[model samples]
Target: MEILKVKHLRKTYHTKKHEILAVEDFSFNLKQGEFVAIVGPSGCGKSTILSILCGLDKPSSGTIEINNNLKFGYMLQGDNLFEWRTIYKNCLIGLELENKLTKENLDYVNHLLDTYGLKDFKKAYPNNLSGGMRQRVSLIRTLATKPDILFLDEPFSALDYQTRLAVSDDVYKIIKKEKKSAIMVTHDLSEAISMADRVIVMSPRPSTIKNIYEIKLTGKSTPIQNRKAKEFADYYDKIWKDIDYHV
Candidate 1:
């Protein structure tokens, strides 16, 4: 079933100098349980699209029709965990914001930490954990809200190359295990291919969908494992070409 629908989405920024069009004629639909990645060049308004979808910004013209019953969770480029707060406390922030910090919700958050191997470090501060572990905590914090759809905006960009790879796998596993639908905005072609079921390629400047590829790898595997698939290189090359052509 269609969980989200965006039609003719357009965003314009008006400054004293002139009007700037960030997104134009953009439209897409997300299915339940699907992981979709949006990829484009640096100034392609990828992040703007995400902000509009998640209600951080409004579209100038067009419509976004989401399942009214669904909730949203956003994970940004940085982990954004509080330095002074313990991992457990950080994870509870979301639930607290939504006023859903009941016993049942707390139990679910604890279960997520335990299932993801962060149970032992619940009392530890974010600084005490490795980069990957901290990102896991950030993800867990988002999940604690029990959102129906997740919006990931370059969530691993701050990590080193190796840690980014490992953490992507960790995140992919958690999302799949929780059966959540996600839309990720990324610049890395390989990362997009590894983690997404479909990749939406956008054009530069006033961005719109240039191409969409349905990723079909050989096996059920983690993001890192998917990177090793035979079709991985092909998908990478194709996406690279598409972005390259647009730029």
Candidate 2:
């Protein structure tokens, strides 16, 4: 079943000097439990599409239809964890805001932390945790809200090379295990191919769908493992050519 649909979406920014058209005539549909990645050049309005989808920004013109029963969780580039709040408290913040801090929900949160190997660091401060651990906490916090769809905006951009790889695998597993649908906006072609079931390629300024690639690899594997799949290089080269043509 389709969980989200965006049609003829457009966004233009009007400044005193000139008008900047970011995205134009963009449309796509996301199926339940599918992981989709949007990739484009730096100024191609990839992030703009994400913001509009999550209701952070309104499109200048278009239609966005979301399943009435679905809830959204957005994870920004940074973990954005509160320095003052303990790891446990940070995870609880979302539930608290949504008025879902009931015993059942708390138990669910605990289960996520335990399943993800963060149970031992619940009382630790954000600074005390490593970059990868902090990102896991951020994912846990997002999951705490029980969202049917997740929006990840360069989620692992802030992490170092090694940590990013590890965290990407960690995040991929968590989302799959939880059986949630996700739309991720990322610039890294390899990362996109590794984590997404399908990659939506966009054009340059005033972006639109250039092409969509269905990533099919044999066997079930984590994102990191996907990188080592036999088809990985082919997908990478194809996606690179698409983005390179736009550039």
CA lDDT scores, all candidates in order: 0.93, 0.93
TM-score of 1: 0.97
The residue pairs that clash in candidate 1, if any, are: none
For 45-138, candidate 1 gives per-residue lDDT tens digits of 9999999999999999999998877999999889999999999999999888789989999999999999999989999999999999999999
Q: Estimate the overall C-alpha local distance difference test score of candidate 1.
A: 0.93
Candidate 1 residue 96 Cα shift, in angstroms, is 1.2
Q: Clashes per prediction? A: 0, 0
Positional deviation of residue 22's Cα in model 1 after best superposition, in angstroms: 0.6
RMSD of each: 1.4, 1.3
| Residue 121 accuracy (lDDT) in model 2 | 89
**Model 2, 1-247: lDDT tens per residue?**
9989999999999999999999988999999999999999998999999999999999999999988868999999989999999999999999998888899999998999888999998899999999999999999999998999999999999999999999999999999989999999998898999999999999888899989999997774888888888999999988888888542
